[model samples]
Target: MAEEKPLTVVTCTAPVNIAVIKYWGKRDEELILPINSSLSVTLHQDQLKTTTTAAISRDFKEDRLWLNGEEADVGHPRLQSCLREMRRLARKRRGGSAGAAAPLSLAYKVHVASVNNFPTAAGLASSAAGYACLVHTLARLYGVEGELSEVARQGSGSACRSMLGGFVQWLMGERPDGKDSIAQQVAPETHWPELRVLILVVSAEKKPVGSTAGMQTSVDTSLLLKHRAEAVVPERMAQMIQFIQQRDFEGFGQLTMKDSNQFHATCLDTFPPIFYLNDVSRRIIALAHRFNAHHGKTKVAYTFDAGPNAVVFTLADTVEEFVEVVKCSFPPESNGDQFLKGLPARPASLSKELLSAVVLEPVPGAIRYILLTKPGPGPQPLDDPNLHLLGADGLPCPRA
Candidate 1:
C-alpha cells in the first residue's frame, strides 16, 4: 500500500541482419517459430539500424506506439505479444503474485517510439532491428534479464537473430510452445577482420509484398517451400556454419548465392507468386557471377532479402576493386557523390578487361545509394537521458 515510482524510461538500438541460409516459412504463426533453421550476419548499427524507447507512467491510460514519426495501432498482435511476454517475465522475476497485486501499476500502460535509420519494410531487416531494440529497452526498464531473443522472436521471427552479434543462427526447435526456438551466435563480431559487406540500396520505395505476408503465402501454397524447409535448409545450415568457421570464402559464397536463388524460387512457386526482386536485382546477380568467373574463384557473393536491394559480401583486400565494378555497371545519375556511405571505400581502377568481361546493361539511377558496413555488436543502451524518444508526458517527442 505504498507509493510507486513512475515515468520510467529507457532507450536502445539494434542492428539489422541479412539471412544467408534464408528463413522462408513459419511453423507456428503465433509463436513466430520458423519452419527451418537459418543463419545470418548482423550488420553494424552505424550503417543500418532501429532505435526505440519505452516509457511507463502511472498516469498513462493506455498503450500507444509511434513508428517512423507516425502513430501506429497499439493493438497489433505481434507488438502485444512482445509487450506481454516482457511484462510476464518482469512480474515473474519480481516474485509473481506479490508484484502483480501491488499498489504499483504493474499493469501500467506504456508509450513506445521506434524509428529506423534505414528504409522501413525494404527487406533490410527493419522489423528485426525494431523488435529487438524494443524488447531489449523494455527489459532494461522492467529489470527483466536472461535470454531476451525469445521475447524478440514473438515480435518477428528473424528479430530473434538480431539479439546477438556477428554470425547468428535461429534453430527451429521442436517444442510446441517454442521455448527452444532461440538464436545462438555462431561467432563474435571480430571473428573475421577481413570480411566486408556492401549494401546496394536499389530503392527506398515500399515493397509490394512484405516478408510477413509473402512468407505466409509460401507456407500455405508453395510445395518448394515445404521441400526447402524439410530437405534443403538443414544441410545448408550446417555447411554454411562450417564455411564461416573455416573462413572458406568460396564455399560460403556459393551457398549464399544458391540459398538466395532458392528462396526466390519458393516465392515464385507460391500460388500467386511474390516478386521481391526487379531488373536491377537480376542484373546485380549476373554481375556477381561474371565478376567471380573473371577472377576464376569466388571472390564476391550477392544475396537478396525480400527486396530489390542486393547485399554483397567480399574480403577487404578486393572490396575496393569490386566496388569499382559496381560503379561502372550502375552509375548514379545525380547526386552521385552520396552513392556510398558507412566505411570509406577508396577508389580502385576498373580496366576495360574487367568491364568487358562483365556484360550488364548500364542502368543509371537504378540504385539510391550504397551502405558499406560489416558485423557489429548486439543491442546497446544509450547513456544519455536526452536521447530518450518519449517526452515527460509519456508521448513521443516532436521528432519521435
Candidate 2:
C-alpha cells in the first residue's frame, strides 16, 4: 500500500476594511464588479479580523467548510467561485511547466474553517475580510502567487480591497470581462501614522437588508444612485485620494462625511426606501457635526455602511477628547473600563464651554462599545501550529 501523504495545513488572517468612498451597486453581479470605484482603509487585524485554516488531504472524502464554529454549506455559489478559481489557477501553473508532474495535493479535497473576532454581516464589512482570508489562505496552500485581487473580488466586491494593506482603491474598469477592475494600494499603513478609527457598535445584530440585495434594489430603482455613480463619485474619488496623499485632515474629513451622507441619501431615494440608520445612528451623526462645529473646524467625521453602526475617523490628538464626548452623549451601562476595546485611550476632560456648545440629552447604553483601531496591513500568514482552526483530522477544533 502507498504511504499516506502528510496533511498540509495553512492558517492566515485578513483585516476588515471600512469604505470611506463606499461601493454601493454592482455593475456585474456574477463577477462582483462595482458600478463605481470605491476606496477604503484597512483596519488593524489585532482588533477586527477573520482567521481561517485550510487543509488538504487525499484521505478526505469531500470539501467542507465551518464558519464561526458551525457547519456551513460548502456549495455556496460565492464560496464555490473562490474555490474553483483557485484550483483553476493552480492547475494552469502546473500545466505551464514542461515535463513537470502536477502535485498530488492538487487533486486532494480541502477542509476550511473560518472565524471572525468581530461581528459578522452587521455592515462592518465582515464578508470583505472573510472572503479575502479564504482566497489568501488558498493561495499559500496551493503555492500560487502573483495578483489575486481579481479572484477575491469574485467572492465579495470589496474583498479585493482587503487583499492589500493601508488605503486601497477598487477601480471600476470599463470592460466587459472585469479584467481591469482590481484593487490597488493608494498608500501604505505607515503613510499616515496619526490617523485613527473608532467603530461605535450601536448594535451587533445582522442587518435586515443584506448589502447584495440592497444594492440590486438601489440600482434598479434609485435614479440618484445613477447620477452619483456617473457624476458625483468620480470627482469625490479623485479629491479623497489627494487629501490622503497630502495628509489634509480637514479636506479628508469633510469629503468623507459628504460622501457617506450622499451614499445614504441614494438609499433613501430608492423607491419604497431603505433605512440603514436608526435614531441612535442619526444622533451619533449629529454629535459628530456638533463636536466639529464647537471647535470651529472638522475634528471628527462619521460614516455608516449598510447598518446602524457608525465608524468615526479622527487624528491621534483628537481621539481621546472625541471619545470622552461620545461617553458624555451616550453613557455606558456597563463599567467604563469595559466600554472601550482594542487600543488604549487615555481619559480626557471636556471643557465647560465646549460641552455647552454641543449639548445633547445623554442616552445610556445606546452604544454597545467602541473599537479603537487604525490603518493596518492586509492578509498575513500564520506559522504557529496551535493557531490552526482545524484539527489534524481536517475538522473544526472544539472551542475551549
Candidate 3:
C-alpha cells in the first residue's frame, strides 16, 4: 500500500426520514431491531439534513468531535459505538487483520464536524441523519469498502435508511444479533417525483422522549405495543410499499394516517403513558381529516413522531391547498403569522374538559414555526477539498 496519507478529509450529508410504517417497539435495544418492519422517505437536503465532515491525521493525538462548530464530547455510548464501528471497518479496509506488508499501524486520529439544517432531537430522527453522515464521511476517509447501508446500520438502526435516497425500508431483521436488519431502497427520488412534504417545526425544543428510551418503555410496559408490532405492521408494510410503487396517493395517505395514530396510541398505552402529541398536534390531525373529508378525497395526510410537530404529506399540486388550510387553522402572532399564507389554519380541537384541566398555563408559543420539505436523497461525499476538516499535516483545521 502507498505510504499513509498525511491528511484525510471527507464531507458528507445525510437526509432525514419519516417512517410511513413506524418503527415503534424494539426487540433488541442495543441492536436497534424493531419488533416490526418500518418504511420511510428520505427528506430533502435543504429542508432537513445533517452535513458532516470527518478527517484523520497523524498530527492529532485524540479523536474529537464537533457539532455545528461547537465542541461535543465523543464519550456518549451511541456516538462512541458509531465511531468504534467506523474505526473497525476502516482498519479492515486498510489491510488484512494479520497482514505482513510493512504491518503499517492501522490507527489514525480523527476529527469530525457536523451541522443540521433543521431541529435536532425534536423527534425528527436527526441522529439518523447525523450518524449516517458520520459513517459515510468516515468510510470515505478510511476507504472502507462495503455497502453504505452496512456501515450505516452499525451507527444506528434507523440510520441505515439515511444511506439511501428516496423511499426506504429498515427491515427488522429476524436475526438475534441484528446483522440482517439493514436499510434497503424501495424507490429513488425520481421514482415518484410528485411527492411533497411539509415539516412543521412545532416547538423547536428537543423531544423529551428519545426513540431509544421511549421505545424501550413501550416494549416493557405497553401491552398494545407488542400486538401492533407483531400483527399490525406486517400488513401495513406490504401495503405501504405497494402504495408507493403504484403511486397511489389516496391509499398511501390513508395508511400514513392510520400508522401514525396507532404508533401514538401505543405510546399512550404505555405504563404511566407517554404523551408526545399535545392539543395542537391532535388539532392538526383533525384538520387533515376535515380537509380531506371536505374535499371528498385524500389530498393530504399527517404524521407525528415523539413530538408535538406534524409532518404533512401531500402531492405537489395540493401543497398550496394544504398550506391554505394551515394558515386558517392556527392562530396568528404579532409577527403577522409566520406560517405560509396559502396554508389554511383551524383551531386546535382541545376538548373543553381537557383545556379546563390545564387552562392556567398560557399558549404563548405552541410551535416555533413550520418547515416545508419534500422527499430527498441520501449521503454523498462532496468533491470540494475546501469542505475538508483536516489539513495536510493531519491536523484539524482551526475552524473545525
Q: Largest lDDT belongs to which candidate?
A: 2
What would the per-residue lDDT of candidate 2 be over residues 1-400, giving only the tens digit for each residue? 1115568889999999989998999989999889999999999999999999999998899999999999999999999999999999988887887776564467789999999999999989999999999999999988678899999999999999999999999999988899899999999999999999999999999999999999999999999999999999999999999999999999999999999999999999988799999999999999999999889999999999999999999999999999999898889998878899999999999999978878579999999999999999999999999999999899888860
Expressed as tens digits, the lDDT of each residue in 17-136 for candidate 1 is 999999878888889889999999999988888989988888888999999889999999999999899888877877854535432356888899998988998778888999999999
| Residue 86 in candidate 1, Cα distance off native in Å | 0.8
Name the candidate, 1 or 2, with the larger TM-score value.
2
What's model 2's lDDT at 48?
A: 93
Error of 3 at 108 (Å): 1.1
Regions more than 4 Å wrong, model 2? 1-4, 99-101
Better of 2 and 3 by lDDT: 2
lDDT of 3 at 374: 75
* True-structure RMSD, every candidate: 2.2, 1.7, 5.6
Worst lDDT run of 10 residues, candidate 3, spans 354-363
> Compared with the true structure, what per-residue lDDT tens digits does model 3 show for residues 225-344?
988987889999999999999999999999999999999999999987898998888777777777777678899899998888899899878776466456545644645456542234
How much is 189 displaced in model 1, in angstroms? 0.8
Number of the predicted model whose TM-score against the real structure is largest = 2
> Model 1: which residue pairs collide?
none
